[model samples]
Target: MSDTLTPPMQSADCWTRREIWQQPQTLNETQRLLRDNQGEIERFLRPLMEKTNLRIVLTGAGTSAFIGECLAPWLSRETGRRVEAVATTDIVSAPDLYCEGDTPTLLVSFGRSGNSPESIAAADIAAAKISDLHHLVITCNPDGALARDPGTHSHVVVLPKATHDHGFAMTSSFSAMMLAALSILSGVAALETRIDAICQAVSDILHNADTAMADLAQRNFSRVVYLGSGVFEGLARESALKLLELTDGGIVTAFDTPMGFRHGPKTFVTTETLVMVYVSNDPYTARYDRDLIAELRADNIAAGIVTLSAKAEADDTIAVRNLGGACDADLLFPYIVPAQLFALHASLARGMTPDTPNATGTVNRVVQGVHIHPLNP
Candidate 1:
């Protein structure tokens, strides 16, 4: 945890643990990078946005894809335009269904390495299918395929180098890319005033929740379920993936909206399960989140239930500091910290290396064995 990052209490050799701890620094740097490049970004996006019918499709794979999922609804309302989250894998496999040849579209690609086969194939498929389209590549790796060859009608925003996690599971990389997209699509200046509060909250969570989440890991809960509403739903999915990935499938995980969980999914819980909800900050949405948490508490089925909230109103929430007033979108950054830490700790508790948790080579850092089948002519 050198290079301006806070020291890690875990093994200094664990890059994954350090990556999770480095998010505050990475997010802050991402914001600054966007600020410095706002002018150029505006020049690229302004004309396309003026079309009034420009469709924004956020695409990636795995955690990167979830970035779009988390922000799609919020971005849609904020931009007053259609914003959809479609994974690059889906686009590659079924390009005709996901790609619109007629509509003016903006393909927003989020990638840490920007080198995934599906990610590359998805972009090519979009370019081939969409007649009026533009590409926005938000990636951490400046040398990745997405960044290096962002096409003729594309612009790439390479984040701070620190975000390119050398570790197998993405920690800082996930938060950094999601934050970058939120700032870019919503407007960089909107976040200028809010960045400090978000960063401080994240730093605080890293320190405050460290011991508790690690303690939870020691229990060795066999299953974990994450619940959220609105923007957090995508976050919930990402959180579930983080745990499953970090623990190398030793821990099965699931995710859903608090309300949606009742539709038979709640049956997955057992005495060995741990349920964690990313409580929404929106007044109306928070009600549903709290309601579900209460229902789960009353059911008393799971081994444990944790609520990650920015508001102090919720008793026993791993409350994030200084951002209660922040929008649900803003809360995403800090809210993910505890889950990230928990996953790392869980990996360590299982006697696996957090840096490369997977014992088998089935999954590579930048996905592998993906034969990009030719798009049928």
Candidate 2:
């Protein structure tokens, strides 16, 4: 290998591998984007929440879809209403199954470009079927068709331009949009109370990202398995996808619920694979996470292991401490950044562009080729 002590050349507008080293500024911008726009996002959702029989549907595709899945449990608890995260593809392919009966629905669409065909189609399907369907489009691109969709009786909330990641995988954009939805649908009095703590938490992770990524990159595993329970399960799914996407399928990846992994899926683990487990802060959930880690160690099937826990005191081989409050499901927000960074760096180590790794061009920042078929009469 040539002894060039620099990262690969990236586009002028894109962030470099070294830039990924500067997580402090990037994360600070992430917090400011959310903290500053809290009121605007909340105001946009106020009217939608006011409607009776309000059914909140969080819809998006892939990582965008996981944002809703991660927040669904906490949102339902906070709002004291039905909150469901449905994939836009699922809705577009089978709207009647997900749309439910003739109720007042708030279809909150999460997207980076807000122009995915399935996303826009899902919104249209909801409007055509549900008479009282309202929309809240959480997106990064203001010029995207979903933001400009005149047909939507919706309020489009565009995040800061910084939130629009140049990477093929969604990074800051995912967290920012998730935070926007949290502030609005969380039923919290004011977002300011949590801002300081969340910002601090993000800063701590950013400080640790370079070290974590350096270590993870050296492992050079054939496959990586991520495990989580509860809301973290969705986070694991997103983490796995980030790695797979950024690596251009160079590394086979998998994610499963802590409990679910034991049933046959554990066979996928080999001595050449790395496993990352997210231990829940809650006692019972933590037990499940611990048991899986124990089993993996006993089997000696993993090349290496990493565990993210609320407290520093984990009886595991590799542990990252994240001591924080147990305030609802909002905990997943800060906990997820490290995994995202890890995946990005792993991609870089393989000489892949985290910004646009899909060499074959099958996946994309915004998916395409779907023709929105009209719902038949």
The digit string of per-residue lDDT tens for model 2 on 105-224 reads 888899888878998888888888888888888888888878888265677777777666666777767777787788767643455466555555655555655466667777898899
Q: Any idea what lDDT model 2 has?
A: 0.74
lDDT of 1 by residue, 1-377 (tens): 22255745545358887788888788899999999999999999999888888899999999999999999999999999999999999999889899989999999999999999999999999999999989999999999999999897999999999899999988889999998889988999998888888888888888899999989999999999999899999989999999998889999999999999999999989999999998887888888988998899899899999998877664755988778788999999888888888998898899888778888878789998999988787
The candidate maximizing TM-score is: 1
Q: List the residue pairs that clash in candidate 1.
A: none
Root-mean-square deviation of each candidate, in angstroms? 1.6, 4.8
Point to the candidate with the largest lDDT. 1
Candidate 2, residue 235: Cα displacement in angstroms equals: 0.4
